[model samples]
Target chain A: MLGLAAVPLIADVIDEPFYTVMFSRMLILSIGAISLNLILGFGGMVSFGHAVYMGIGSYVVGIGTFHAIEDGISWMGNGLIHLTIAVVFSALTALFIGSISLRTRGVYFIMITLAFAQMFYFIAVGNDNYGGDDGLSLYTRSKFYNILDLSNDNSLYYLNFTLLIVFLYFSHRLINSRFGILIRGAKSNEKRMENIGFPVYRYRLVAFVIAGVICGIAGVLSANQTDFVSPAVMHWTRSGDLIIMVVLGGMGTLFGPVIGAVAFLFLEEFLSGITEFWQIIFGPMLVLIAIFGNGGIDGILVRLDKWWQIKK
Target chain B: MNWILLLEQIMNGLQLGVLLFLLAAGLTLIFGIMDLINLAHGSLYMLGAYLAATFTNWTESFFVGLLLTLPACMVLGMLLEIIAIRNIYTRSHLDQVLATFGLILFFNEFVRLLWGPIGLDIQLPEILNGSVELIFGIRYPAFRLAIIAAGIIVAILLYLLVSHTKLGMLIRAGASNRQMISALGVNINLLYTIVFGLGAALAGLAGLMAAPIMTVEIGMGEEILILTLVVIVIGGVGSIRGAFLAALLVGFIDTVGRSFLPDILGFFVTNDVADTAAPAISSMLTYVLMALILAIRPQGLFPPKGV
Candidate 1:
């Protein structure tokens, strides 16, 4: 946290301010990845359309700003309204998508989610009022008047960083709570959980919504960072990328997604720099990981910790 | 309403259905027998197109190219099953999903490297390039007509192969009870490899058929892959018969809806609203169908055995 807090100052001193901007994206996606871990890692629901919530969050901001600029709908420009609408609307969307997607288990569930996300993506691509396939741009960041100003990059970065920390604390509490235990237990053996007098479906559904809401907030931040919203925001490949982050970091561990997100960005950045066909190498690595079977980068750290303790 | 135009559209839908069936048959069988989901099934479709394009360029015959593409696809399929897929059989569904997803990345990039970023084109044979006129002056592409005919032929062949042949009996036995079949001294591992190859060959055939109409390009698999996934899901996991019916239904809904939905919606709404909603709704139609079906019958329309 101290090192992250110092990023802006360090970037300015080193005259390489792009690091602050870049880290902002990684942190936001880390939040998204973490949200996914709630269901994917702990609750045993692999939602292939997790990023659709993020896209919905973004479009809320984009549509708000669109109306604000085009029709003098100033209240739509308020960050509070943006966040509230994003939250409520995303929760509702998640409910609808989850109800349908959760009906079938295993590969069927994955396909349904992928199919539904594709539906949303196509709708965004088709809506000409929101710039069609070109996407919508924010004329100005959502405002809080005297209370906050997102127009300042530093303030925005600080706000994102603060939110990330708050989310970290909240999720930590969430996973260890009784509710969290129920959700995780359901993942282990849903039939037993149901037989033990818990309504596993409802429990899973609630977790799904909570995860969607958090990921959606990350989407809002990402849109704010880019100042644009498009169907590309929730493309299946983007969702796949999020899943990769969660898996690569460590599924059932907190902070593993953060590690995964950072590692992913680094791998993408470094490998792309080496050659354009980086997927050839990166693709096989995932296969090897899946076949070998461990938690992820966090899993590696955990094993190392055990080894060190034994040595001592 | 123009019945002739509708008929032409129905033909288009049928051709698409045939293509989907080819892919879905293999997918259903693989799932039924091996209990595997190959997300890279679509990648095989893509490779088939690329292979057909190359072979056509060499042999100067599309039919010969297609013939050549099938065996090639089977070999590639078996190789993939042996190399990458063989390792992940007992892994979790998540592992299978991600690893196959990895295969997609590898196959997509591998294609890009070998074929270049530009897409390849498959030329239709001369006789098949012209239009076939039906009754009432309705006309359709002869290539598409050939596709439907070929699909029927293959479906018949597949039916005979699965219903009568010794291999077909073994496949049925494997699908019903893997342990019993293996206990009976059948080579279970070899059966899996052969099934995977069969699935790949079918997907490749679909790809080669699709190549003439659409560009033989990278990532084309993902789009059709989603559609085929929808088909198998709606059809139930293991039943080839279910896959067949579901593929035709989805293909018709997609094609007919895309072409006529605006007009249909315009009946009850303003033209502007219809125009705006048509594309979005058309694309969503199949997914919505799947959701609704699963809601009422989560086992899908024609599930054969316990999920």
Candidate 2:
């Protein structure tokens, strides 16, 4: 609730083109991270290929805009159709990969997902038509009935913000549903869930597909925001970044991924400005967090809340 | 493809598979025995290559440089284990992943700082620089053949050590049940350190050997590390025998697919389409194999007993 009120005030302070752009980027990434948390945090599915959904989303925007520009198609015919295709495709791919990957527990799941993501990355790089290593550019942003002028910074930022809110609400509701309980239970103990007559694999697969679809939506927003898409979006390191965001925010919480994404991007921007070797500091910082800060930023907040209660 | 060319490619694939095995063996063993995920294992490989390159430049002798650098990598591995890894044995995979990933970023940046962003080439020894002619006029690189031979020797030695030696028995036992082994009064800490160091050394050995063939640069380990992880997954975590076979399967599939997929696809489609699609398909081949294997056997081809 505090965050809800602070949003406009924070926006008013950084009410510039650059800050608007950065904020929108953070929102899109937060959406992706939140989607990942649904599967990884709640369902115990450690996917190293989550970035592929983002790539799929971005490519949908890029390809849709590209063909629309060349063919003069209507916004509904081009933009909406392409976006639908992207979400469906990403979900299907996630379903196929997750079905097999979820069969293996623990380290095997992690490695297989990583490899599959890398495979998609290589395929994207190999496709010369899609700009290969250079990436594809949208000549213009998708014409969304001009209801939301993506070309305008403020307008686009709000659109992303609205989308983020919708997705967060959707995710929150999902987690509190009966389906969510099964997923959480499966994560806690797969054997127990199975013994309780829930088909653990089926629930996890559904969660995986849902996560993929959400990430696909984020990817579309990312493509619209940047007006570009590339194989780099699907790289394993990119997946690692998403995982870091989730961990940083405090996995399984409603606001954790958003906080993580905002903090991470801001840190990257601030640190990179200080020195070219920013990663040297950032890397050790992550290690320190892992070693000492087990619960991430949100975890610390919870601890503080408990302490305050004790004091009272 | 000509029979001779096919034979050459197969040999090349075998060589690549062997190198992957050396790296995967260490990774799987550590994961299986210590129950720790070490994402920075690739950094040790990069270090070995960098150290080998530096020492070779210093001594002007590849063999001598390798001899000195191998033990150095082992020590570095042990030291890192003591300092960072030992503390995380009881932590979640997420912590291990993040911490090790941080190490990778640090090491990559550190390497960039030390050696510029450009890749360095490690020259092969003059004695092993040339190619050898086999039957049917086929020729193969001596260095590649040496890598294959070394891989085989290591595999045999590892097999002997794991199956025959007391330490190997302890390692196998520890992998199956760590608490039970500790209850038997074995020094778990020392065992973990040694296992981690051994794993590092094996990864380093792969790096040193591969330095001549592949580019030596920052982030070079990332791609190969993914492949090594695949090998571990397919072979079954903590099983040396599984790592060996899976590594070979991955190496052969990747090499052969890259070489022949385009030509084979051309027969069915237009050359232009085949040319464009082949690379993508070939790159996805190993992953397809991995997915297929997991779908059939979730525990991998030979999951260590009790893992």
Candidate 3:
């Protein structure tokens, strides 16, 4: 809450493109993290392959815009058509993968998802038409029917911010709904849910699809923000990064991933600026967090809230 | 296809399988005995390659380097188990995954910093450098044959140790039930550390053996690590026998697919398209095998009873 309230104030004081760009990037990444938390945190699906959704999303925008600029094929206004296609494609892919993967449990599921993602990563690297390992560039942002100019820094920032708000709202509502209760219950105890007459697999699969769709949206924004899409986006290591964000923020909390994404990126930017051996420091820090900080940043906030309520 | 080439590819597949078994043996043992998923197992392999390359450079003798580095890696393995891994036995898998994943990042970067990003060649000793003539005018690298010999020897030793000795019984017992082992007054912590150290040493040995044939470099562990995971998944989580068999199956399928899939596809599709699509399709072979295996038997081919 404090971070969201302070965003405009921070924007006002910074008044620079570089800071704005950084903030926008943080928003997009946070969206990705939050999307992952839906499945991993709430639905109890530890998919080590979530970054594929982002890759699919980014590639959709990249390919769509590339064709628009190169071949002059604008099927619809701006790039909304492409964004929708990306979301649907990502969701369908998730459906296929989840059906097979959800059949296994524990470490097997994790490894299978990881292997499938690596397959996708390699395919992206091998596709010569899509620039192969070099990646594709979007010379122009999505047209969006000229309702908004994505090239403008402020316009893009607001666009990302608005999407972030919408996503958070949807996530909030979904988690509070009856469907959310079933999913969370399944996460806590799948057998118990099954005993209670809920088809646990169906609920988890739905959650997985929802998470993939949300991630797809983030992917489109990411491509537009960076003006590039590459195989790197889908790398398993990137998926690991999203997992770190969710865990660091306090898994199962609505805003925990958001806080985690902010802190993680800021720490990366800050530490890398300080030294080339930033990962050495960051890596151990994450280990220490996993070992000691089980509750994450949000856990600390919850404690503070309790203390404040007592004081009042 | 010519029979000789086909036979050669089969041999190559077996050789690859033997190499994978060397890596998977330790990995599955660690997973089975300790209930720990050590992603950093790959880092140990990477370290072994690095250490072997560096030591060989220093000693100017591959034999001497291998002799010296074996104990050095074993000691490093024990040290790592004591310092970092011992504390995580009771933690959740999520925590284990994150912490180990962090270790991977740290180790990869540390290796790059220490050895530079470029790959190093670990030259084979002259004694094992040449190819040996086989029947039908076939020839195979002597070092790879040595690797196969070493893998079989280790597998036999592992089998004898696990099935025929006191330590092996304890390991089997531990895998079956950690709490029961503890109840029986076994020093479970020490046992876990030993198992982990052994696993690490095995991984290091595989790395050292692979170094001369493949370029020793950072992140080499990641690809092999995934293959090892597949082996464990197909073989069964806690069964060494499963790992050995699965490793061979996976290795043969992968090798044969990559080698023969193109020519086979050429008979159906145009040569140009077949050449391009074959490699991609071939790469999916292990994953397809894994999916099929899961579909048939979710617990894997040889999951330890009750696991």
- Which candidate's TM-score is highest? 1
Off by over 4 Å in 1: none
Candidate 2: give the clashing pairs: none
Candidates 2 and 3 compared by DockQ, better number? 2
Residue A207 in candidate 1 has what lDDT? Answer: 91
Over A193-281, each residue of candidate 3 has an lDDT whose tens digit, in order, gives 99999998888888888899989889988999999999999988899999999999999999999999999989999999997878888
lDDT of each: 0.90, 0.88, 0.87
Give interface RMSD, every candidate, in order: 1.0, 0.9, 1.2
Q: For model 1, what is the C-alpha lDDT against the true structure?
A: 0.90
Measured against the true two-chain complex, the DockQ scores of the candidates, in the order shown, are: 0.79, 0.79, 0.66
lDDT of 1 by residue, B104-220 (tens): 999999999999999998788899999988887778889999999988888889999888999999998889999999999999999889989999999999999999999999999
Best candidate (score: lDDT): 1
Taking the candidates one at a time, how many backbone clashes does each contain?
Answer: 0, 0, 4
Pairs clashing in candidate 3?
A78-A143, A78-A144, A78-A145, A79-A144
**Per-model TM against the reference:** 0.98, 0.96, 0.96
* TM-score of the second chain of model 1 compared to its true counterpart: 0.98
What TM-score does model 3 achieve against the real structure? 0.96
